[model samples]
Target: MLRNRVRELRARHGYSQTALANRVDVTRQTIGFIEKGEFSPSITLSLKLAKELQISVDELFWLEEDLDE
Candidate 1:
């Protein structure tokens, strides 16, 4: 599964969902979905998020391998 630190970063940056969404050019619901792991962002969007959060994509997102997998 795709694991992300979007919520953590957003909080650390003192940004609300709507604020971050506006910076990333997406709907607040999209930011909410991303935080909830209900959606995966495209590469471009991921880069934008990473940039806005002042971190690298690797730091923002990673793959979590399930034991069964």
Candidate 2:
């Protein structure tokens, strides 16, 4: 599964889901889904998220297990 520190980073940045969504030009539902691990962002969206969050994409996203390998 893909694991991310989106929620933690969002809190540290003092942003609500809607606020972050607006910054990333995505919907609040998209943020919620990503946070819940029910959805994964596309590369473009991921870059946008990383940029908005002031972090690297690698820092934001990772694999919880190397199951695919």
Candidate 3:
């Protein structure tokens, strides 16, 4: 499974779901699903999110098994 710190980072950046979605050119529900771990964004989307959040993609997301490392 892919895990993300989208919610935390989004909050730290002071963006609402709609705000981030608009910046990322996705729907608010898409952001919601991503935050809830119900959706794994495409690489392009991930890059966009990381850019908007001013972080690296690796910092924003990781595989579930990576937690063991």
Off by over 4 Å in 1: 67-69
**Which candidate has the top score in TM-score?**
1
The TM-score of predicted model 1 comes to 0.93
Output the worst ten-in-a-row residue range by lDDT, candidate 3: 60-69
Question: lDDT tens digits, residues 1-69, model 1?
Answer: 788999999999999999999999999999999998879999999999999999999999998885767
Candidate 3 stretches with Cα past 4 Å from truth are 66-69
Q: Using lDDT as the measure, what is the rank order of every candidate, best first?
A: 3, 1, 2
* Model 2 residue pairs with clashes: none
TM-score, predicted candidate 2 vs. hidden true structure: 0.91
Candidate 2 — which residues are off by over 4 angstroms?
Answer: 66-69
Error of 1 at 27 (Å): 0.1
TM-scores of all models? 0.93, 0.91, 0.92
lDDT at position 15, candidate 1: 100
List the global CA lDDT of all models: 0.95, 0.93, 0.96
